[model samples]
Target: MTASKLYILDTNVLLHDPKCLYEFKEQDIAIPMTVLEELDDIKDRKKNVSSEARHAIRAIDHILSGASTSAQITKGVPIKQNALNGVDTRLGKLSIFPDHELTMRQGFLPNDHNKDNLIINCALHLQATNPHREIILVTKDINMRLKALGAGLLKVEDYRTDQLVSDIELLPAGHYQMEGNFWEHVTDVKSYQEGKYTFHQIDRSILPNTYPAEYIYDESDGFAARVISVDEETITLQDLNHERIMQQNCWGIEPINIQQAFAMQAVLDPSIDLAILNGAAGSGKTLVALACALEMVIEDKQFNKIIVTRSTPPVAEDIGFLPGTEEEKMTPWLSAIHDNLEAMHEQDERPQSSVKYAIEKANIQFKSLNFIRGRSIQDALVLIDEAQNLTPSQLKTIITRCGKGSKMICLGNLAQIDSNYLTPLTSGLTYIVERFKDYPGAANVHLEGIFRSELAEYAEEHL
Candidate 1:
């Protein structure tokens, strides 16, 4: 097959999604030797991305395994489309560009011991060698793309294979607010009662973009309901008592706002398997999630244990260097959870003792995101904090570990993503919110209005 374009992948692109090799259908892919060297160096590191680097290396090795000679390796190997998701199309070729051998030329980017410059030089060499074909340099690094474009490489682009949404605003908020009374928008409605709960079957046109577990609320009428099911013709919504939901206490924590109430309701619900809560910092995502988790595990006896894990930036490299057990090492990163627990029991005469009692009674276990792979967690509430820093693939690795009777609560602040490679639109939190909106078992609630303090609310808005 005649390849349409020659795509040169940067190391970060492969690290972002190792399986991205098969994503560019019918187009040839060229990996620079520098990228391989970087992956080799990163694979042995004590970092979160080390696993991703290993996966990327394995993917490249699998594709090039069938190559018989160096000439065949450089020339390219056909990507086996049959093994990839049953895709029957004529796939493209995968080639390893020997950028190390490229001679520095006039007007070309000076290598300067920089891997990015070498990769750019490879694209330039490829463009010169394959004059008639399109050569595009794909990198997840914004500055790398800019540098590639400045170095006379044409068609520089960011890796968009795992990017689910083009705009962060397009992401689902897990709830919709109507302009006026929600009842006024319904043209046809059939109300029914089952097991003391009221459900209304409304025409699909009432909320065309609605999805399961998304709440519909009208402030004017003081009404709210959760979408239970959606069909082509109609949508079934279960009536929610707004006052009751707001008044419900979870381990001495009450919802301060309607969005928080919706999030707490989702977390406390027995039917929901995955509840995602995202918002600005100090929006009480962790507090509410932890409170509900404690309520279920300690008071309600809905689960056997509470396993809390979050993406720790420093823990990636320094976790082993810290003294004490895994949970003790994770305490600094998970301090917010402890603060929430303390706040929950602060009103008691012996707050510290109460916090200790709750921890022991609920079997709260602090875990690291890196060590959670390949283990099945059953009959527990898995609370993932700072989820925006995780990639979709990494989140999948953790999410798939959930066994029977496990509930996952993901808390994130999209505005506060600290990962250099991740954006709000590409965050695993955003990915799952969009991917699972249609599923009946999951719910996402974007909490608004910071309730931490007056200063926090002002900072969230102005700063």
Candidate 2:
């Protein structure tokens, strides 16, 4: 029989996903004393990290509480699969490794009191003592994993339990291109007309797993349509009336490309409550979102007001503390919002001061995401900028707060996530784009063309 491997987890692995303890089935799991210390320090932090830390500590405490004695915990306790609501079922032993003489014998530098190095020392001690079993250090920090391998630990890996995709390129762009001869494949179809749109029903077998609001285009024929309904037998598509809408100005701004036009249509539709726009740095994700929101709140009178929020992340180093109200502190992070509003005002041929006047009269609100809990926003256009920095849990909280008659628009560039724990594949923006793709009231667009400026586009491409 093959011996089970011993996996030593870092504090980041726990904070990234609190349920990671049960992911390693039938393998011995070790938690270093240094990791517990780190969790204790982080348990009181704000937002997702604190919630994850507290949940992880509680899970560990729950397991230890059922143990017969403290010595039983030291000797290793069996992690039953039935504990976590019966989702995981692997009989593995869990033990907390104390900082002992074995760790000191590893000969790490006495002055290197960093938590990462101390965790590596614990894994090294386990490898030295247990010759028959393999020991691996599982960490989410890339630099820590590299440091462990450089320190002569042969087994090291990243925690990938929460990653939805192995590569960012594999994520769906929410659209598909049909061949020039696409109409030749359709047979036994039903047709009808509603307003300016011509609806067609084709067999669902032709496009398996096709989702509502997904765009399909044929370049050669200059034909485009969006899936409106999906049934077990057939899918209904509505011909895109791009000519009229594409030429119409949205709040004095025009879409520069076909993708942007599609985004405008999705945002203007009152039936669709959720819209996501993702793109490169200069792809106008924020501009289109802000324009549509202003039009909805001011020109159309469809929504009561506009609420804007975004993640606050420093560029290089922490700026310590700012003295002011919540909105004053958020001004530094929301410069893009201010810039886009000013540009819209200029396009409307209004005086510069009118931007502030319009915002105040229209009841536009700038909110910090930190205080969004327990409040239901009704009949509002809620715009979440820089959404890539949010975790799935944070995104869920924001989405669930949308009350009746409210719509949400998420704008972000996946390449520019600033959160230390989030990545393109595991970000909250990506999560919603994938999960809500098939929902009838949700639509997504990936804008490609850069409309900010020639210099900005050049920098985005080359640098």
Candidate 3:
């Protein structure tokens, strides 16, 4: 019988997903000592990944806690079965490899004090010694995968346990567009009125892919409706007037397109707890979100305050050294929010005064993502900008901080992801959009077209 494959992990893989320890089902996992050393060096750093490194270390320690001897640890430790997460049987063993003591071979890549070379050397040594087992090296770094393969490792793979979609193109667009009259497809429909709103109960077959809170629009017939509820047999859609939605104004800002109108409608609705907006860089995501937030806080009195935070790049660690209050320090990262605010009030006779009045009236607060971990925000409208830079775990940490009577709006542009560890397919924005599609209290809109400028639109398409 063929033996189970031995999979080796890299440092970035653990930092990418700390819970990855149990994700590999029934396969033996080997972590080189270099990875531990790297994690040790990083666990004490002030970066956002330090917490992830510590979590990875704790998971490793938990798995190897029962071993009494170095010999037993070197050989392998039986992974404890976790039935809660669906690990029903003890079929995998985890071991640590001492890569520093690996003997050099004639064709092996020179270590030269490089950490990646050390990891590659360990894989080469393991492959040379264990001829029967198929060894695979898993890392999130593309360069590390190339180096491992170049050093003669048989199989190298990426850590894809958190990936929800194989391709970004397969992701849902948050709204459906029908070419003709939407009623043409409905064979059975029962229209009714409930509290100044019209709802249609149609056979489920008419819109099999529709989900709650997703919009269905027909440009030809100028009809739009939102899927309010769905059952196995029928779907209930709340009818919306296209012209009325387009004419809706929030803080003097009206929707430029139907997609933006959909976003504004979702954000303004008090029943929706979460709204995700994704589009090109200049697609008015930030503008629309901020406009709705201001209206909710200052005009409608729905929310008491507006809390804005975003995932800053790890390299910008000088936020602590910057001389100012928390809001001032966050000003650099949250400049986009201010820019949108200024744009909203640009036509005012006293633009700067209007901006200041708006800020004070709304009780707007800028916060750092690192500082928002433990606090629960109540009666607030939270706007998270540049969300594509975050991992799924990081996004979850912020989302859970929303207490009762608080709403969250996440705005991201997948084309401009700045995180080295993320791609459009693995982005947290993409993850949430897919995970929360069917949720009744959440809505997602992928705003189309760049309304920022004609030049910006041309660059988005051509450049």
Candidate 4:
């Protein structure tokens, strides 16, 4: 028998990651009519709103067909997928919505500055009618959850279907240990540089992100040093021979971990124009790069714009066709882009309005690589988020978009690729690293830490 549960979803959550729907499958979902309205508002967005966005609309429409209707609009119908529709919930059962003649018009109405409030009210309406059912408000925005908790709503979780792993997969506090004499060197620096040396620790495999790894110098001089390896120890790092190191803390992120510090060394190095940062889900790769880029933008006055760009693959998304003005179609896909901006400003204590001001001034632009052919952004801080989903060819196009005096940061988790012709190992993140291994102007860093939350890190690993 199907149990009773009522769920209300926020629009930001859906637009950020469309897979939010399945997380509440078979539950009595009160689609905050306002969310539908918001979705309708952006139905013509071309860039980030993939055909999947339109497909999501059609998918919702299909679910709407079977739901039972009450006399008023406050009713929710049990949703089941149509076999022909291919939107199966897998645990589907029949449901109905209140068929009131008012069509929910008389119910709690939404207003300006009231989107989040209105969604919660819709969930409350469902809770009132369902009598003995669990009421949940599923949202990715932390503030929304806080407000919902203040309003007395319980039983909410993020949309986990698209999540790479679960809470149980997180490496616990004690998973990594560094013992004495972890590395036995087979060659000296001369031979090692010649690719004749291989280092190994008997009966022990080095873990990711753990450093200060002790390695014995097998040379006639006989000394000790730290070793960092990438991809089966084929490529190893003995040290960062930087001329100077900068002192700055990443905002809303921890002190630059060893991996990130190494990455920063390259980012700050005048030699490196292209660098790639890859890591697990909670890694500080993106945040660190973001902080450094913003640092240059604010303090150094180095660039005119921080042109942030990312790509999303379409799967029947068909955003209904993009006839509207640019900003109209661009708003839906740039939420995360804005989230990062907000966080940066939020931490810096600069007027929170700086982000919006920068965007309005064209100092911060969110672009899609879809048709970015001849446009060159010179002297800018360009950040290409989700570089993992981009093909090497596509990545090339984005990089070539950079102009003189511009620095581009590519951040993504190789474990999570969404583009075509790419896998974890073959993604652009890895491709960039392997190709630029010896380039003086290129560096690579892989972050491995949980800045989001303990639970989030756990889920990143376990789920």
Candidate 5:
């Protein structure tokens, strides 16, 4: 029989996913004392981080409650499948290493008070004490992993159990290109018509594994349509009215490319309750979303108002605190929204105060995500920007808040995820795009062309 490995987890792993404790199958898990201290410090933080920390602490306490004595906890307590809610049946042990023997390592300083270095030293201590067992350190921090490997810890790995994809390149583009003879094959499919739209039904065998609202284009001919329905036997597609959609202006903004046009169609379609827009930094995600929301809420009167929110993960140094109302406090974070709104007003040739009047008369609200829980939003256009900074759990909380007669637009650039716990593959925006691909009334678009400026495009490409 193969011996069980000892997996030492870092604080970030627990913060990233509280349920990570049960992910390792039949492996003895170790929690260093420093990790527990860090969790204690973070448990009283903001909603997202605090909730994760609390859950991790609860899981540890529950596991330890099954043990009778401190000796069992120190030596190791068996982690039963029943204790972990039947997630895994692999019998392993869980222990807390409360102390580490002081040792002199070549790379890391002995007197260094850094938490990362201390965690590395704890893993080193475990390896030395348990020569027979394979010891590994699991962390989401890339630099910490490198430091551990440099200190002669051979086994170091990122916690990837919850990661849906290994690389960002493997993420879905939300569209597909049909074969050269696609139009020729389309003649054989059944055709029908809906209100102001034409529909075609093709055998599922012909286009296997396609999703609703996924764009399918024929390069041979200038033909494109969005998948409207899919089933066991056939897929139904709605012919895209690109000319009409592009020619129509939304709050003084018009689609500049096919990608942008597709995004506009999805956002403007009353049938699609959810739309996800992803692209490079200069791809005009916020601009397109705001334009659609303004047109719908103000001009068309399709929705009651526009509600804007975003994840507040800092890019560099975090400002300690700001003194103001909630909306005033969020000004720094929502500057992109203000910038886009100003640009729209300029394009419309409206006076500067007209922007303020539109905001007041249209009943636009800027909200902090922290207070979004336990509230129901109805008959509104909810725009969540910078969605890549959110975790899958946090995203769920926000999405579920949408009530009847509501539409949501999620916009983000996966390459610019500011949260330390998230990556392109694990971000909430990516999660929603992949999970909702097959769901009806859901659509996604990846805008490729950068419209901000030539300099911005050059910086994105080369810098």
Candidate 6:
């Protein structure tokens, strides 16, 4: 009989995702004896991760509590077990389930370092006796995975519990293959625009001219989108309401020169769902996104809200205490977002129901980044400002928060990474762009103008 396959889930995977136990439906995941030890310590610490780690520890144990007999353990499926027997799970030719206690220990006491080594060693030891069994260690920490590899154990990044499919194959996970003469097939953009359209195999890194709009061949049913109207500064679409929709099609939110137009249109393209803006301060990343979102929320009524948040991550340290209502907690985090909103209001006419009218007429809901959990923000326009400060996992949570009839714009300067948890290339926003580039429903726009002042762009370039 073949030995059952074993997947050794690492501590970081559980910390990143509390539901890691359910990800690998194919194998029985053994909590590395070492990982259980480390988790015990982390469980007691007064940190954001303590309760979650503790919960995962408890959850894993609960799943496998029924296993008792050695004969029952090795022959059938693990019965979806999660046990942490301090003693090794194996005994000479016989199996001792979670109840087996360690009489003499050869490893660490589940302290951080000993814990990691123990988990890795457990897999190595398991491989020795169960020569036919496949053992894989899964983790989110690159360093931990590297360590396991150095110790001669196979390892994989834990992505099963994550909403973001890590760099999956470029082909459509699902696609909308529209027939040729597809544009001609549709009598009018409005007539057959009820369902959403997805353009497959979009390459964000390619030059603009290379885009294949004519081949927009897919008719997938997902968050529905449409091409309502197109202009130099905007391409408007309608939601289920049959209302007018507008996204930034102009070169800039309010461009001062012709050069800003191309970049702005790229930024506004609803088809282009991602972008990278790398100019120094005084650039228009915030304004352009806000303007586009505003246009969608007010002018178009495409969504019910204009949600803006920032990562405000400590490149190393924690941000100072955030206090007050959701809006208040966001005060410290959204200075850039506030500045742009204030600028937009500065030019407003205060016309009856004007600023108030757009928000009131459109029924816009606003909230901070730190306060966006446990809510399904469906059919909304979300702008994740200061995206460079977010980790890849953080961005995934935010993007997954998008409900039906929603569009998310992640705008940031790669040169400005403030999250201690991530770097420019590794920041959550860039990771999503790089990872999701092939999906037809998404697009990428890289904006390069510094509209605040040419001096800012000059310093960014020459200095």
Clashes per candidate, residues 3 or more apart or on different chains: 0, 0, 0, 34, 0, 23
Q: Residue 379: error of model 6 in Å?
A: 7.1
Deviation of model 4 at 445, angstroms: 0.5
- CA lDDT of each candidate? 0.89, 0.82, 0.88, 0.56, 0.84, 0.53
Order of candidate numbers by TM-score, starting with the best: 1, 3, 5, 2, 6, 4
In model 5, which regions exceed 4 Å deviation?
Answer: 1-3, 46-48, 80-91, 100-111, 179-182, 347-350
**lDDT for each residue of candidate 1 in 404-456, tens digit (9 for 90 to 100):** 99999999988888887788888888889889978999999999987789998
Where does the lowest 10-residue lDDT sum fall in candidate 2?
102-111
- Decreasing lDDT order of the candidates: 1, 3, 5, 2, 4, 6
Pick the TM-score winner.
1
Looking at model 3, the pairs that clash are none
Model 4, residue 331: C-alpha shift (Å):
3.5
lDDT of candidate 6 over 185-241, digit per residue (tens)? 333332333356332222222212222111122233112232333334333333321
Residue 186, model 1: Cα distance from true site in angstroms: 3.6
Residue 62, candidate 2: alpha-carbon lDDT: 71
TM-score for all models, in order of appearance: 0.96, 0.90, 0.95, 0.47, 0.92, 0.55
Candidate 2 at 66: error in angstroms? 2.7
Cα lDDT tens digits for candidate 5, 1-463: 4346999999999988888887787788989888999999999876457777988999889878978887789778777677657655656788998744466655543646788988888888888878998999999999999989988887999988877767778777877877774766654689888777899899887779788889877766477789988889899989885466557589888988777888888899999999999999989899999888888888999999888898887777777777889888878889898888898888565657878877876788889898887899999999998999888877888999999999999999988988878888788888888788778788889998888899999999997
Candidate 4 Cα deviation (angstroms), residue 389 = 1.2
Please list the Cα RMSD from the true structure of every candidate, rounded to 1 decimal place. Answer: 1.9, 2.9, 2.1, 13.4, 2.5, 10.3
Error of 6 at 308 (Å): 1.6
TM-score of 3: 0.95
